[model samples]
Target chain A: MASSKAQAGQTLWAKMPKANAELFALTYGSLVTELVRDYEDPIEVNAQLERIGHSIGVRCVDELLSKADSSNLGSAVTQCGNLRDTAEVVSKVGFRMFLGIQAEVGGYSQDQRSFSIYLQENPLSTFVELPTIGDEQSSSSPSGGLDDLRKLKYSNLYCGVIRGALEMVNLKVECTIVRDTLKGDELNEIRVELKEVLSDGAGDDYKEE
Target chain B: MTVHAIHIFDRKGKTLFTKRYTTTKQQLMQDAEQVSEQRKLIFGMLFSLRELVGSLTPEGGSPALQSVKTGAGTLHCYETISGLRIALYTNNNPVMNTLPGARAAGGESTSITSFQTALKYIYSEIWVECVVRSPLYRPEDIQVDPLEGRDNNAGRFDIKSTNFEVKLDAYLSSMPWFR
Candidate 1:
């Protein structure tokens, strides 16, 4: 099953439209820099990035659905039987098709309500490093301090993207950046918890006869 | 084979678009109320039938409603992963229904697979292109037209683009059962 999903992701990645990775990275970096400068708080900048990502995610999901169909992946890409399937698709196919990167799904909770996505390489943070002030450990500093460096989530946009895309498919999920390579972690990880599965009310009016 | 109409519905059972190929004067003269009522009735029946079929199937998979045949006509259904349902209503051939063995007598039998393929083609090729990709199309916004207020559920957000209508008509007219 893992191999098949990986193969699917590879095939989709090949078919995807290509863009200059450097330019994309630089543009995202400039946007984050501007947000940090304007907001003057790393936490607020994270929230703003997520808001922007939510709008992008809502529109990208439709494109993803149509692209999946056009790629001839058929039912495999469309119908996700369980949360595990959804996670695998999001990591292997979703990330690959969108960002042209491979991510692994692991760390499933015992209740099967949540899982973690481990991304070895984040395209958004290719040339990014959290700036730290040497010997200035003051907590009162509004910007550029070791304290603010730890609070900044460089790739929080991915969390919002996952949340918004899943909501469109009636899966209400909460995604958070649990681990970041920018924060000295070996890999970046996004933790996703299934909050609720929205009912489309198809059987609401059905009366037993 | 004669196609009477085509209807598309969103996941919540709201009518997105309904195109009736009015052949006779009787059908052409169907009032707005009658048409809207018919759309609601068809959707209700489909929803109930789908649930019934899903429950009755021995296999542990969703068995969606494929077709419904009556004395007058037949209804073929195809639903996408996004929960969009597209139904085609066509006149049934009396000769084939009377003698099941005579289905092979004609080379042009309206098999379920062919209809399913056609419906999927309409979805992936026509509907996705014309309606989904259009910048002006907003699926969630409900229009406040007083004329369609009689049936609130009939026209929530219709595919009212002239380009979409022209393409859909052209594709359906090219089908074998259109006439």
Candidate 2:
């Protein structure tokens, strides 16, 4: 009986190890691609890339500390309270490190009355490449191409890192990436907007939920 | 750490020219010798009478003898005679994202009639290293191969000049670095 339990534990560990490795690889690869597509100079690009990743690490460390509340873990283990905290930590650290950037705390819509953060930059703007084909010409225009691009699904690789790090903290929060035109510096602002979906208390509904 | 130079290669395996920094000092005597060799080779490859000299000059002293430094992270640029350009930059600065589409089109390639006007952009921004272009011919000519020889790499692409509408593959393939 003891050996059977041990075998089950080992199988569980083996099954998850590959998934975690794949996630790490994907996160690192995407981070590199995003950097390459955006920057021209390698030195500045590489330095900023590492700095951003480092900032993620630093914030993740703090999040782990608070969530785990284990003194023994010390600085050796990285943690976070949840995916939301992880995203918040990354965004905060990245802003502070680059462009001397910062975000302002604000309340949600006049009716919602929820809390949120707002990024501010004047010269900063998001970059969107216009398609070379026909009808796409107006895409470069402020309202035409650029606006549509802004609404496209944002791939927040940093948020993925935050999510992965927070998993270490045993915290999971569904995260979304939202873009705000108000944020400048062409900065790719990552908003960890959280959501909660309520479902009927049935096992069948739980799967759909 | 200080960066002394950046070497860039295009999709055609051609070496655009190396961007030599004339300001920073060479760290060791061995490194100084390497720079001297590179300088001689660059001087021999001069194509046009109006050589676009890119120099990083020190505030004082002869720029030629200044120290050239190498560090873990720094940006570098290399340009092809046919107007193909590649740059490698440190991954840390937020400004890196601003250079790809419009900012990189700094009028250098305006006169190159034969070259395609396709822009090839690539980077590992999280690590601060990347490459960008103004514009080029054929959208398909630009490729970002993975560091690993894996097929399932998500972000990597295989851009070729033949994939473009214009044909600058021969010119690009004949670059100094390609040899």
Candidate 3:
């Protein structure tokens, strides 16, 4: 009985059922499709996508905390501790808890306020092709320069989620997809930069201003 | 301890999914309207208590509310930092419900924490798999219709995620304390 109970605590992701990846791909595909159809400008599409992502991030963070309330989580959520610990939890815990992805947290800033989460295995790209030369969508830059990507951040919403969730935890941070395989980068990396930590009883003041 | 039901809510006080595992004699589990009424009251009461606890904190004194108990077992509530609320009201046997306390405190809460953790696991994993990940259901906030009438479908709202139900049932039955 004890062994089984122990197993329950450890059976984190491997034991849990996997979400239908096709469904995830198709879902994202449909969302992008809707955004494209609605907005003429790709910049607008990116903003809307980020907004959608922010809402999900804010909620998904709650879901993440709800599912696993560990001692580390208590500190991490209440008053976020050191930079490394916070990034480790975000890269490791957040991904595995939600998508069963094991990401490596590294590449810290000189001041220790920024870091990159290397997403080696991302489910979002299983069906998504990398943006490359000769991709002939109107949204794509006519010159096909790097400027094309300036308009569309394909997975900006995921980054938005991280930012939104961090803000909800009283940690004001900026999360952006610095590198993406979808954008011809060798790997996908999420760069998180700490802006400020909203301290005790000062949350409303930030909102009021 | 017996968790009679699990109610999941969004940050905006919307009911995402509610699953009742055990039947209670006090509130007829089979009655649709009565159960809905009870569920709503439970949501309201829990929400109010949570807000009160957060508000009543002396300026700069920030402790939070965990659980509330009465003759009707205990209401173990776990609120996420982002304001999502999940409440589990159990009607365990007298011994399992032994020495009920006014609030979720000390040792009783350790077990509750572990259980809540497991429940959280289910929420993030199974529920996300079956509910949120579904493109058809929503990528937006779930509409929490306070006035949406109750249906006969298990005496409440139906998210129709059979996979979630199956996984949750399997997990609960595997637990030694589930009885």
Candidate 4:
């Protein structure tokens, strides 16, 4: 309870009961929808959402770093160096701390272009229902809508955190949410690809400066 | 240590901005200049103080090390061209350890106090200070000073010792500038 209290004060999901995960997800979705509708500027909304995500990422990074005992041993140096290691830490630490889910780190590609983290179950995202307002009702049935929601891959929130934290380290990465991975599957897998454009250019300006 | 520069892009993958700051004032200034220019390419900047704090991570040494989630120092930065949003958040509050008092206050009874505490720390102390002081923002544009209200079910507790959620609806609703 003390740990929960301490963590609650710091994390985005603080005070969120286990029963309320679905509600929180729905609220999160609705908030995004509302922001998009009100702003009507994809750039602004996306940027704002990314900014929010970035902040969360920064906080999450702190949490991840603190939890790095010998049991979770993977070189911090390597984790700090490559995006793959960082992604592993993100999925592992993110699930353990926030979602109460244990995520498995999957294979890393040879070129290091892509890596995967698989969540056996996402309790936080389960049972989320996007409140259908006027006009959106008849277009899709609840089951179909739920399926669509289930297909929602990646927490832009976590993506923002990863992207932002990497930026703090001066690593330019292009993060994409792979929705296909979230489809009917036993495990919820997210594939994070490090953008080639920036990776190729890494350390170029820093060395010169 | 290798200093890596991260290029920030919009959702469309357009290179809207990039910045790299070292411990040196010269490098910080240069990075600030680059960020300023990029801000012009993007819209105005609207960021919380925490983002500014997070941006200071690359400067190196104990300052950067201490600044992580446990540091007491303030982080501040802004891109005027990016719509000039600034954030100032600290990971250095000892009050978080005293959740028993907060918890004893109870959810229903202490809801207002909890919300007030969160606002006091996050918005007023961290956010507003950064905004008012930033060169990017006009004082009059802020409109509401220290937006405050209560959060009913907003609270998070974990091993990390952080759980304070102040509803941003009033602040969001009041921000005529925020589209």
Candidate 5:
């Protein structure tokens, strides 16, 4: 069967399955807000959040790839693609499947070792407010310069998600937050660097991005 | 709209986690053994029903059976591409039950998809955070040791149930149907 996404060319983005950004925002907000209440150190909470995202990524990949198999889309791009094609499928198809958004793919390395997925819009930011350094806050020096340097990395969870998802798909990739709206950047870009391919090519027999 | 309980089962019909909330019925399960037995039975029934429905439909059916109502309550199920199965069992609201002619004729399919979706998010958001990321819990440890009498006990992963319980309570309480 042709993918529902492919059939609706002109209105594909509009036709794609969408969820209320509020739902994700609130859920993520709750987790983040709770971490703030529990840990005195925001940096520690940042690491924990990424770790949590990694766990989520591994399982989310399971949900994504398996569902794709049922639709036959999983096999069409299954494996045997060069690094560029794999990255393209991941940034384009995978993003659409999960978040109902398309990512801009660019900044690929000549050695085929890295690429970046630019998220023009972030659904996870609906409820995210960059934490401000209170005037009386003692975590940083009196100078706001030091405070600015101490970024909370609210979207690091997403970086971990990329790493976790890629690892599960048999591509050992290091996912890093190249840019994030949380830190005043206009775009949320995640740079994915291939570390090593696992012994089993696709993780599963025919797992796609 | 209230989620009574959420159960995650592996491919072999073993229970991974079955967290009950205020909405779950008491008489259906009296003790731990009874709870496990009832879960096993529910798993078996759902498995059979899925196969039955799949066989009855043609190629490309309208997304597997959505929800089914039994005499007790309603069962909303979501199956992952992998073998993990998450089922949300909820009791019919007393108010809905009292509506005349509604019970006999069968009511409309509840918008339980939202609840199912939330549960899937919970699987990724909470369960993975608690079970998969924690140093205390090992994925390999989720196994059965008959001699130790921990059969089908989710491989002794030692889940921090209290944390999940608190969050689930908060999550259900936040839903509009909780009252």
Candidate 6:
């Protein structure tokens, strides 16, 4: 299962139109900085970034589905059966196809309702670091020096993207950044918890004669 | 072989587009209300049938309903991962599977797979091009209740765009079994 999907992701990544990686990373960094400046509050900036990512995710899903099945055999629908499959698609196919990066899926909860995606290489954060306030940094060193860095999830946009994309496929999920490399964690991990499987809204009111 | 009709439904079981051919069997319904009622019945039946199929499958995977054959006709369905469903109604006695020698070698399954492939092509190539990628198309508008008795074109959405209609007709007509 893993090898086939990884191969599929690699092929798709190869087929996708190329973009400059540095330029892409810098653009995202600029956007986040602008958001921080505009929002002032770290929490608000994170929320705004997520909102932007959510809209992107909504559209991204269609593009992913269309491209994933280059064979166009309508097999894309049957690929992801449950939460496990969804995670594999998102981490393997989704990340590689879009970002040209491989994300590992691990840390699955016993119930199978939740899982974590670990990003060993986060392109968006390659050139980003939380700026510390002068003097306040020295005084607040004991209090975890950079309070904003603690609150601001620099790559929180990924959480929203995952949530929105899964929702489009009728899987309502909650994504939280459990660990961030920007915050000195070894890896960037996003925990996804399945909240519900939305009914297709095939209205029960419709009665067949 | 005769392609009788086609129906496209969104994930919400709302009919996005419907077209019927082969009216020789019966006159087309003149009443818009009657046509919509028929669409509703078809969607409801498909929804329940899918659930039934899902329950019967031991593996309990996604609801896989490839086709439903009745004395009248056969319904071939292909659902994208996004829940966009394309269903085609064709005559039960498909000419492609009737070759005497081919029947011994599982020709029926081959024909069904081919039909599904055709449906997928319609979706990924035609629908995605003319509708999903169209700048004027609005995905949000699909939520509006057509049963609310709004304008005649309210429920039609962007799928009825001239470009989509032309492309769909061309593709369907190109099929070997389309009559």
TM-score of every prediction relative to native: 0.78, 0.24, 0.54, 0.39, 0.50, 0.80
lDDT of 5 by residue, A81-200 (tens): 466766766666667666776677789999988999899888877756664555336543323333442456777787777777777666778887879887788999988899997642
* Model 3 quality (TM-score): 0.54
- Tell me the deviation in Å of residue A123 in model 4: 4.2
Sort by DockQ, top down from the best: 6, 1, 3, 5, 4, 2
lDDT of 2 by residue, A1-209 (tens): 22332233233233321334345445655555465546533344445554454335433333323222222221222222233333344334323332234544344334332234455541222342323335455632333333333333333434454443333233333333355343222433444443432221212211422
| Model 6 lDDT per residue over A1-209, tens place | 77677777777788778888889889998898777666667788789888877767876777778766544323432456678888988998889888989899988899999999999999889877765554454542333334564688889899989987888898999988999988789999999999999876674335453
- Looking at model 5 chain A, report the run of 10 residues with the lowest lDDT sum: A200-209
Model 1 per-residue lDDT tens digits across residues A1-209: 76677777788788777999999999999998888878877889889888877656665676667667666776557567799999998898889888988899999999989999999999999899776655366554455655575688889999889987787788989889999999889999999999999876543323334
Compare the candidates by TM-score and give the number of the best one. 6
Model 6 preserves the real interface contacts to a fraction of: 0.45
Candidate 6 local lDDT, B1-179, one digit each (tens): 48988988877776777777767533454466676677777877887887788788787455678999999889999877787888899988676524356345444556787787688778877887777777555565642333446566554455555387788888887665676
TM-score, chain B, model 1, is: 0.78
lDDT of 6 at A41: 75
Query: TM-score of chain B only, all predictions?
Result: 0.78, 0.22, 0.70, 0.20, 0.70, 0.80
lDDT of 6 at A57: 80
Tell me the deviation in Å of residue B64 in model 5: 27
- DockQ of candidate 5 compared with the true complex: 0.05
User: Which residues of candidate 6, in runs, are more than 4 Å off?
Assistant: A33-40, A70-82, A135-150, A204-209, B22-29, B60-63, B94-109, B134-138, B143-157, B160-162
Q: If candidate 2 were superposed on the true structure by all CA atoms, what would the RMSD be?
A: 25.3
Candidate 4 Cα errors over 4 Å, as ranges = A1-23, A39-48, A66-84, A129-154, A180-186, A196-209, B1-179
| Model 3 regions more than 4 Å off | A1-40, A48-52, A55-159, A163-209, B21-26, B29-34, B52-64, B92-114, B133-158
- Candidate 2 segments whose C-alpha is farther than 4 A from its true place: A1-94, A97-100, A108-115, A122-150, A153-155, A182-209, B1-179
Q: Please give the CA lDDT of all the candidate structures.
A: 0.76, 0.33, 0.64, 0.41, 0.63, 0.76
Clashes within 3 Å, all models in order: 0, 69, 1, 41, 2, 0
Instruction: Estimate how well candidate 1 is docked, as a DockQ score.
Output: 0.30
Q: Tell me, per candidate, how large a share of the native contacts it keeps.
A: 0.32, 0.00, 0.30, 0.00, 0.05, 0.45
